[model samples]
Structure formats: C-alpha cells, structure tokens
Target: MGEQQIPDATDPASVEPEPQRGLSRRGLMGLALGAGAAGVALGAGGGVVGGIALGRDQAQAATDAVAPASGIHQPGITTPVQDHLHFAAYDMMARTTRDDLAELLADWTYAATRMMQGLDVSATGAVGGSPEAPPDDTGEALGLPASNLTITFGFGPSLFDSRFGLEGQRPAGLERLPAFLGDDLDPLRSDGDLCIQACADDPQVAVHAIRNLSRIAFGRATIRWSQLGFGRTSKTTSDQATPRNLFGYKDGTANILADDTAALDENVWVSASEGPAWLAGGSYLVARRIAMLIETWDRTRLAEQDRVVGRDKAKGAPLSGGDEFTAPDFAAVGSSGKPAIDARSHVRLAHPDNNGGIRILRRGYNFVDGTTDLGRLNAGLFFLSFQKSPDSFITLQRALSTDAMGEYLRHVGSGLWAVPPAPAAGASVGAGLLGA
Candidate 1:
C-alpha cells in the first residue's frame, strides 16, 4: 500500500492530493532494519502558526531533538487516517520494569524526532479547537506537498517512578516529569518532562514517524503500551480523522472545541499549583487516556447495550434522534414503562441535567497492533479530550463507572497535564497562560 490518506475536515475537496507509489519493498525492508543514521540537527523546519514564524531554533529546542542522519525503509501497509483512532494498554512500569523506563522514553523521543524530520510539515489548528483542521497544507495550497504538522505529547502517571514501583519514594526525575514540557507545540500547555508528538500531512510519513519512534522506545523501555494513529491516504493529503478506541465507541465526545469563545474560556484557568507566568496562554490541565473493554463489551446484547448507552449501539444515534449528539427524547419510553434509554445509561447518566447539559470534544483514533494473550487485539483511539473542569468529565464517568456500562470497561491507562493555551504573536507557545 502507498499511503492511506487522511480525510479533510472542512471542504473535503481541500485535502492533500496523494503520494507517488511503489518504493521497492526490498529496499524499504533493508532500510527498516538498517543501523541508525548519522544525527542531523533538528529544529523548526520553517513553519508558521497563526501567521507567526515558529523559528527553526525554537522548534528544535521545543522538542530537544535533532533529525536522524538517515531515513528508514518505507512500509507497504501505510496506515489510514480515519475520523478518530484510540488505543489502550497496561503500563509496564506499573507492572514490573520500573527503573529502565527512562531509557526507553529517551529512545522514544530520539526515534520520534527522526521520523518527524521526514513528514510533510504544517500547523493546522490553534492548539485548542474541535473538529480540528488537518495538518496545514499551505504547501499543497501552493501546489507543493502539504507541510503543516501538529504534534502534542502527554505523560501519564504510570510514566513516573512513584506510580511505577512499590517503593515508598519515587525514583529521581520521575516526579519532575510532570513539570517538564517537551515541545510546547500546543497552545494550551508548557509543562512536563518531554512528551513529543509530531503530525504531518502525509499519513504514511506520520505513521512511520510514530511507529518508528514507538518501536525504538519499546526497544529500550520496560513499559507495556499501546498507540493509535491516523495515517495519510497518500503523500499529498492532509485531511485526517480521529480513530476509535477498544470500547468501539468514539471516545472523545467530551473534548473542548477550538476557535470557539466558550471553548477558549472554558479551557482557561488559574492555579498556583501550576508554575510560571509565561504559561498563561496555555491550558495545562488535561487528562488524556485510553480505556479498553471491547472483549467484554462485544459480548453484551446489542439491544441491552443500546439501552445502557442511550444511543443506538450500531448507529450511535441518541434515543430520540438521528445521531449521537442529536436531541434525545427522554420521555420516549417503552410500553413496559422502561425508559427508552435506561435511566442509568452512560449517556443518560452522563447528561443527567437536561438543561445544564454535558459537552466534551472527543479526538480519538482506532488501532490494531500485536496479538495479546486473550487473542489478536484490535485497538485504536488515542483517547483525548479537553474539559473546563474534571468535575464535568468526572461526574459523568463516575456515573458510568458504577452503572452497567462499567461492567465491560476498564481504565487501562491515564495521563494528566496542565495544558496552557496557545500564545499570541511574538510569544512562546504558552505566553498567555504563563503570564509571560
């Protein structure tokens, strides 16, 4: 396969064109297994965000990365970018290997840095937006390969030492990891050790970068993990969709929308616990994670499952309407007097207040990697969402956790961060949130 293209967000016609096919398989395989290439200095490869020049120096420092001396072999199975992709996995550090996880993470950053160097780069959204624009395609708009990219990184508690081992005190640097901001590519956050995510218009390039980095990290790290991605259909397109997670449900229904006043305001916050004034333009507090329970979930009856979730299991439509978010007629109950949607269904339980309402913008993807003890695993969504407060998301999840929906679901991994808002002109990524 050449490259599976990412679908466009706005006018589908505006997406990238496509990549040329057939890079000899034998050559690609050899490159995949070849030794690491000489290191190349990594920096902003000349890109702009919101009309501002994100300098090469700043970009390089943001990721603390340098390009790979050489590239890897191209794979035939180029991943596709769907509406969303999600993934979930047990943390290896939490289970057994705690001390060596850092080395693994270091390698992850290194490999990822290399992979990104090969992508079609551009910046699509303003750090905080829903129905986010795919990678910037200014290059394509100008009749060149789309070059915009958006990469965000998140570190879960499991990545830290305290959560990794049974010992009383956490290993050094693990605690500090939470405060280290890898690449301040996102507008909302600028704290945390280093969690680097790079996006590009070409799905093949993006997938290769991610998988290569992840595989490199796996080679050195001691954590059990999973990943979800949206690869481009071809080298030319930038349109991308989020993937679904193991639960089979589009997981990010509760994320904050971008470019919306309500969303921007909701994402803004003040907390002394978060450091520095330079972090003002940022929104540093987002809890991102993946939950997997499909095996258990798949066993439930479709009708019963629909009732429990308050939506058509297959169509994802609300009890009374056309689609997932469509208005639901709560009064439409069955002759048996049972609510058309169970009173405690995930949806019903989540949006208990018809007036106050619950809203979350979900950005997730689907994934299928290696086989597990259970069987061959199919995973996806890189479950991510932004909320004004944990209370909103928590209240809803708490309800689901205790209800029938919780039976088949399991919280496999979690990552919490203080995401700062994007900065204004001539400012660093989190200038506003950091009070810079």
Candidate 2:
C-alpha cells in the first residue's frame, strides 16, 4: 500500500523478481550495459525528464506524483518467462492545432507514468541479470533502472503548427524526414501535444503503454495523433544466460561501452545543430523503432547466419575473435585468406572504412510473445542514433539494408524526434526548443 520502492541492487529482500525466463547471455549483456537506461535519464532529468523518476521520491515528486491512466497487465496468465517480453516505440511529428496542446501533454505525461508503474518493477527501472530478482549491487555501482520503462520525448517540425505562429512544421510530402517515412508512424494528436519516443523490455507493456497514452492524449489532450513501435529480434538474457535473437542467433556482440559517454558525445552528437540560436545545445534527430521478423530470420542455417552477422552465435564474439565492440584486426585473414571478420559482414557494413570511421549509438531491446500470430515473437530495441545529419543513420543503415543480413530484418514501427542538449537547472522540459 505504501509507495512501492525499487529493489536495491544489493538488497536481496527488496528484489521480488518473477521467475527466470531464460535470460539470454546477450540480453543480460545488453541490459547490464545499461542499454535502455538512456530513456530513463532522458525523461527523468527534469524531475523525470523523459518519463522516469529516480533517486528519491521527494526530489522527483513531480514525476512520482503522476500515475498512468491504466495499468499495464502482462499477457501470460501463468508465470511468464522474462525473456519472452520485448518492445520498442519511438516517433516523429506533424502539425497540430494550438488549442489542443496543453490537454494533450497532460494526458501524455499521466499515461506514460501509469504505464511505467504498471511494468514488472525489475523490467522498468530496476536493472537485473535475471528476471527473478535484482543483482546484489545497485545504485552508482551499476546504474540499473528504477523500473523497466524507458521513454524519451522530443519535438519536431510537425509538433508545432504554422497557423499558431509556430515555425517548425515540415512541408507536405517532406513533413517527416526520410528516416521516419513509414507505415507504422504515429499521427499528430494536437498542436502542443509533446512527441513521445518510448521503448520497453516487453511488447505487451509497450502496447499497453502506447494505448493508454493515446487514450489520455485523445480523450483529454484533444491531440490529433500518436505513433507505436515494433522492434526486431535482439539478443537478450534468458534464464540460462544464453544469448539469442528472434532468429535464435546471439546479437549485440558489437556495441560501445556504457561508461563511454564522452565517446558517445563525440561519435553520436551533431555539432552543427548546436550552432543555431534556437537549436543551440540541442541534440540531433533520433528516430527509432522495433523491427520484428524472427520467423523469416529463423529459416537460415547457423553457419550461414553467423557469416552474415560476423559473430559467434554462442559467445557473441566477433568472427575475428573477442566479444562485440572489442577491436578487430581488419588486416587479419582467416585460413582461406579472407578477412577473419568478413569484409562484407554487418560489422564491416558499419565500419567499412576500417579506421572505425563510422559509429552510431544503438540502444535496443528484445521482445517475444506467445499471443502473437507472427511466429516466435522476439523483438525489442530503442533503435536510436544521433548525428549532425539524418544521413548518419541513413548512410549506415543504407549500407546494411541491402546486405545479406538486411534481408532478414525489417522496420516494422518507427519514430523521428529530436534530443536536445541537457537542460540547464530550473529549465523546463523542451525549453531548449519550446522557449519555456
């Protein structure tokens, strides 16, 4: 009945985790690395910037005070395996009516908070190695989530309407950027309706969160549109700590380190966007989605599939040897004389130049569900990338999209939003863009 507290990473008594759902080594690796933690940091910054409130409740009273319009109920009637759940939802915007803005935002904030509270605490903000409980160490030691929910909000040209004197709307046919053009994109809810880009560890939770947020925006906010996300199968921690994707192959063998914030800023942020007065301190565009296509992916053989991904299925090590993100010797050749890491593999597709010239911050989740008619649901990823130009993500994805592995992946749901610079103290959310 009291305010529910996140389990301490070190306090076993506080961790009331569900049963192990076959934690994949890759999944556990991804979560432990704080892959989804960015969203929490995004929303919770302003007492809960993006959509998460942590530290102490008194300090985050504004964030903790709000509850979602409806609770997120898990799908399985019986004890569900933790790894089976996944979700990735992000969005872009279009013009909205000015009169409807306030109401829409209130609903959105309320819905997001409630939905977050609805998730299994472990999945939401609490970081854990297994589904059943939190790891023995928490807090500054690991930066585990206070909940599984990870939501990020951003503004785009469409969020503002020219009719109201707002000047950010995109022209027709080009309103949304190339990266965000897709079938599953969310519609405008209102002129002032804040754009939401969210991802969860579970799909049912993600869907429920989206739907409930929609109810609030449409019913009270009078916002005109909304978007939902679908993610691809990713590596996740199962009960056994084995790594596997929807296609059953290990994923995320190649990733930047979590502590590498400086590297993230250098490699991912767009310096050009910061030059403009209105855009100063603003981060570049971030468009993301969940892609689900494990069934089609499952048809390939392990050996052939490994070649396409360029990593060992069991260990998540690069074909060249060490685990993902570890440096690979491009000059090294295999027994047949071909590069140990295929010159054309996904790794190579991303780093074709060989100086490690290209990089994008990838934060994705893994999802699976029995209720889905689609075969063996396993998908989850925030699918976020920041750059000076939309071309950064576009260029990299273009390189990989036509490759052998690209054939196995599809973009099911998508979003386009801007992540401005960190807010100054006392600055309101979206202040950098909205002018408070």
Candidate 3:
C-alpha cells in the first residue's frame, strides 16, 4: 500500500491561517481589554467567556516544528520519540450518545491541530478570553513554544459497545488482553474506552495538551488514569542514540526504525484484508507501566547485571561480541561451556528469531512518580509498543515469562488501544470511524 500523505501544518488549506507577522505586545494588550468587556457581557447573560483573536507566528518560530498531524499513520508512533510524554486513558460517561462522542472527537482534533502549531486551543486562546468567564484554554502553556508536540488518539474495545452503535465495526484483533504472568494490574488504571498520547520536548507542553483535552471532555468522559514520563527510553530513528531505561542499560538497540518502511508495513499497520476496513492504515498500541526494583538492581554485581540483560554495560554489545547493532550470536558458547548469552536472558527470549520473527515499534520513557509505601523511589519504564496486532506483543511477552529481567520489574498498569489511521485534510482524527 502507498504511504498516506501528511498535509503541511503551515498550509493555509490544511490549517487555519494566523497573522503573517504574529501578534505584538501592544496588540495583545488591546485584545485583553476587549476580552474584559466581553467577559462583562457574558457574565450578564450567563454565557461562555468570549475573547479577542491572537496570532501564533511568534510562538511557532520559537520552537521546532513537528511532523504534520495528517498522515498515513499518526505522528507520535514513528515521529522521532520526544523527550516527554503525557499519556491518558478515559472512560466514556454513561448515556453519551454517538453524536456526543463524535462531536468530542471533532473538538479534540481542532484543538490538537492548533496546539501542534504553537497556537492556543482556539483563536481567542487563554488570556484574550473574558476575564469573568472560564478561559477556553487552561492557560498553563500561555508563553511556551510548541516543543514539537504530537497528539495521537485511539479507540478502545469499550467504545464499540451499544452506546455508540459501533459493535459491528470493531476490529477482530481488538479485545481484552489475556492476563500475563507477574501482572499486578490496578483496575483503576488498566483499561479505558479511549486513549490519547501527547509527546513533546517540553513536559509542560505535553501536559497542557492532555489538560485541555480532559477539560474539553468534561461531561462526555472522565480520566481513568494518566502517566507522566521524562527522558525517552527508546529511539525511533537511526540518527538518535539509543536511550537508557531506569536500570541504566541502553534500550531499543534492535527496535524497528522509521526508515524501515517494509518492516513497518509488515509489523505495524493493519491492512484491509486484516479484517476491519476502517483500520486499514492503523495500528494497535500496547502500554505497560513497569516498576523497576531500583534498590535490588543497584546492589547486584556488574557481571550479573550484564548477564540478566544479555549485553555489555559500557558498549551495549551482546555477550557473544560485536557492537550494539550487531546481531546477537545466541548460538555462540562461552569459556564456561554455556551459551554466551544466557538461555533465559532478556535478549535471547525476546529476540525475533525465537518468536517467529515478530517485531514491534517501541516508544517508551522513564517515569519517576514519587515513592512507594516503603519510601523507595517510585521509578520504572513506561513501556509503549505499536504493532499490527496485540498478538505480536502477547506472543513475545509470554515467551519472556521466564526471562531473568522479570525479577527486577513488575507490570503494574496496562492498556490496549486501536489507533486509527491519520485523518485527511478537513477531517478529524478517527474520522473513518465517526464518518465525519
């Protein structure tokens, strides 16, 4: 299949046009005064706050531009992993109609498009809006740059229930994942009716996206769980150096790359023949919040740590030798008369060779969320993977059930989502499903 084209965000035909030169301080002051007047008018009639229009050329020029939102596939997955992440899952409120859900998606798409370009959620934006009324935007990201923001949306199995009348359209591969060994899942954080992944170089920018989206979803949905991550744990492109996990070992050396289009099609995007036609160019997302036992791993001997991960700490090379990208010599034996790479080591068990040549695109991050009951640093890897089917992840994870790395980690949270293909110009994300 041909790759879908991603429209340019600066294209006037694709996005709402902003002032050529951007707004000045004087222009902003005048707008603020006008907004105050509008606020008074709104307060008299109990209406939404109104605001003056502002331009975004200044903000756009301040930050790096990201991949366009419209594409064959969504941006966050293969768009060079950002430094920060704000991932959220939501449950549809009871009694929400199909129209209500569709409208929410449209609103979200519009807001996301504007934010990705360094503009506020709406033209009036935060400070320009009525002072007496609630601002349309949350105002936290007022002066921040776009920071290469990208927001990707997905639908969960629960979304296809009678509430939306989409039961017949649910993909065959969309189903609740089977429980795996060592899973200590929290029901409150595990599953949801929908999900959004917002990534940016700046943490505040990413947080702003989710914050505003959740605000927009006030009555239609409620946040089930959310996670904040920093210091990306995986590399999605060849130019980027492999990042390390909380364990201090380099991660994703063997991960699929953005330039590997053939591998991506075979392992990531769903095809029309795969079952659901609407999901033709889409992929499935699997997220796991893994808690690493930092204290224990810190005390382990260096050699043992290397053996557990099956790679050299300094060079990230396989036990059997060669650089980081060299294919592991799993068949090679060591001086002790055993396989150089331990049979149960992470590399041996998770390698595609052992799992029928299955591969996944990993976009994970390191997360530190305060502390546990014992006052231990609550840190771990927020594992994120995208593939054509959840079966790919399930198959690999099951094989790793006996992996030595499991002892140092715990699967505390999990989710599975069907990320639809990117929308065409003038269409919203998931427009294929909503028929908008």
Candidate 4:
C-alpha cells in the first residue's frame, strides 16, 4: 500500500488457480484493454462492458490488499473497514486444558496468515490433499482473491476465572458489562470464552475464513453464536465517507482515523502501564447487536427525526448550522431562542466535548437476519467499537440512556472481550498471555 502497485488477483504466486477460470466474454474485453481502460469503459459503444471493467478494477484492488498477520497491533481494528463481516463467539469444549487453548490459537494464526496472502490454508490444500479424507482447505475460496481479509482474536471475561491459571492476570476493568437501561439482551446470543472477527471486501472470503477457522477448532471449541453483516457502518480511515445506518442517518461521522497515532494511543490502544503486560498494545472490543425499528422510524415525520438525531436528515449537519463535519454549537440558539441542539439529542449526548473528551474507534456493520416471528424485518446495526478500556464505552453509553434515538432500537446481543496485540510472526496469538 505504501508504494507498490497492486499485483493481479490471479497471479500464480499469490493464489493457487482453480481448474477453470471464471471469466465472461465481457471480462475478456476488460482484460484485453487493461492499460487505458477507464476511458474506453465509459465510451459510447461500451455499455455493459463498462460495468465489467469497473468490477475488474475492484477485484484487482482487493487481491492486492493484504493485512499482515503480525504487527504492533492487530489488523482489523484499525485497518480500512472491509465491506463484510463474519463475527463468531466460541466456548471452549468441556474438559479442555490450557494446552488445547494455546494449540488452537497456533493453528488459527497459521491459517489466517495463508488466507490473508490469498493462499490456501495449508500447502496440501483442498484439491491437493488425499482423495479419501476431508480437505485441509475448504475449496470454496479456490479461485478467489484475498479481498483484504483480516481475522482478529479476543478473550472474554469468563475465560479468566482460574480455568487456565489466568485469574491473576485479568485486567482490572475486564469484567462482564453491567446492564444498561434499555438492554433486552438474549443470553443465547451473548458472551463466549473467545471471539473471532473476520472482515473482508468479499462476502465469500469473509465467510470462508470463519468456516475454516471453526473447522480448525472442531475439537477444542464450538461456536456459541454468530452474525453475518453487510454494508459496513463505520470507517477506520479518512478516505471513506460516512455510511448511513438503517435509521437513514450517517453514523460514525466523527470516528477515529487509522493515521491518528496520538488518538490511537490515547483512546484505542491499551498501554502496558495501564493494563496487564500481555494485553499491551491491544484494545477492548464491545459488540452490540442493535435492532432498529426502521418501519416505525420510516413513518416518523422528517422534522421529528432531525430533532432526535440533532442533525439535518438530508445533509447530516448539526442543528446549530454548518457543514457535515462542522463541530456542533451546543450553545447556539435557534430562531425560537432555545438551545439549537436539544440536550437529550443523540449527537449532543455522545459528543466528546460533553463526555470529558472521550472517543472510540468504530468498525461496525449493518445486519439483516431475515423476518422475525412478527413478520417485521429483523435488521439493525451490528455495533462494534474498540477502546483502550471498557470504561470509556460504559460512560458514553450511560450518557445516552435518555437519548431520543434509543426509542427505535433494541440491544439484543452483546459481548465484551479483551483483544490482545498481534503475535510475533510465526507465534501463536495470545502466547504472551498464556506464557506459552
């Protein structure tokens, strides 16, 4: 990403090609006119061919994208937010020993490294393995590119209670989140010993990573709950535009950017001086599956909706007036001579100015799990945030207890996990914590 041009997605060095190349006749034209492609794509004669060329460019960009498995911090938290997510929580199998937990991480790290590079899970992959037994790799991702895949691991509060001699090392603030005012949390969908967050530009690539990782953990652990999300709700870099939630409001308008090192240190990354040594440079992750009542929201008047969010529905600007990025003028008065932004509005309550300058990096997604029994769309924001300490999130959430926007939402699934820093290359994730 620094200076190198993206290599082709189908390059032999990056991916093991399948027996058949999945290309259409129009795709052949895109490959033929590769260099001066854009102008030709928009040409009068090239209608559908133009669409194919655009698709080609996106694929090429994804293939060239790769987040290293080893870094000062894990990749997904601060990586440019991918388009899709496959998040799963796992409970360790009964009678499993500490060694089993350590080995599971080692196996996951190895496979993640390969998949992130657009390679198979192992050298003897799906087709290359023996014909009798199940394949090492799930052959689904065979001809696909890496799609900027990242797999992040985290440990939950329940995992540290003397089960594996980790009780003494638990971070002071690492506990199950206290119940908030509007929580209708489902026990089945909440909490696990471990969590894996897999994100990628391609849905298939994201799903394949989780499927393969879960396969690797077959004996040691099993999935407790999982969620599939599309249309990322937050961005980790400045280049991305603010995305809208199901309520049709642009969310994460003030999210932390990947390049803000000072902000990262202050708000996102855990410091060794502030936490257990093994968790240094890592962050705490809070996952809340918030269900939005879009039908009810859709029927609400436009003016009422604007008042609830404290931003103009059309421009996403502060009610006090200015552009979308303008800092809110909480003190400004409306024509009626009242405070322009309502005190109970979501914006004013969640702002850093009002919360003693608190901020968290958000990398969430929008989810639709199909129709509920009542025949309403079961859809909402799969809210995910990373912070140095869980207290930052708790404080902000408590501040939003009276939020007018909370009326249209429900917190159905929740989990809090302490994300550890990326392991050294070729080392198991959480090795430092395990003292392995």
Question: What lDDT tens digits, residue by residue, belong to model 3 across residues 1-436?
Answer: 3434654544323333322222222223323332210000000111010011113342234244554443577778888889999999988788778876776676666566667767676556787777886666668888887888988888998888989989999998799888999999998878788999999999999999888777666666778899999999899899999998889899999999988999998999898888576788889999999999999999999999999999999999999999998999999999999999999899999999999999999999999999999999899999999999999999999999999999999999999999988765445666778775
Q: How many residue pairs clash in each candidate?
A: 101, 75, 0, 0
TM-score of each: 0.52, 0.58, 0.89, 0.85
Candidate 2 RMSD to the real structure:
13.7
Clashing pairs in 4: none
Q: TM-score for candidate 2, please give it.
A: 0.58
Runs of candidate 1 with Cα error greater than 4 angstroms are: 1-47, 50-148, 153-192, 199-203, 207-226, 230-256, 267-276, 284-291, 321-324, 352-358, 376-381, 423-436
Ranking by TM-score: 3, 4, 2, 1
Question: In candidate 2, which residue ranges exceed 4 Å CA deviation?
Answer: 1-96, 106-148, 168-175, 179-194, 199-212, 219-244, 270-282, 285-293, 323-325, 352-356, 367-382, 421-428
lDDT of each: 0.36, 0.41, 0.77, 0.76
Which candidate achieves the best lDDT against the true structure? 3
Writing each residue's lDDT as its tens digit, candidate 4 over 1-436 gives: 0111222223324322222111222222222332110000110111011011112322233345665332467769988999999999998878777876776676666556557766665555678866875666777998898888888889999889766888998999999999999999999899989998999999999998887777766656778999999999888888999888888888888999988989998999998788988988889999999999978999999988998999997888999999889999999999988889988899999999999999999999999999999999999999999999999999999999999999999999999999988764224568789886
What ranges in model 4 sit over 4 Å off?
1-62, 68-70
Best by TM-score: 3
Per-residue C-alpha lDDT of model 2 across residues 295-394, encoded as one tens digit per residue = 6667777878788877777777777877644666667788888888776677667773743466555444454334465455645343544444455566
Model 3 stretches astray by more than 4 angstroms = 1-4, 11-63, 68-70
Best of the two (1, 4) by lDDT:
4
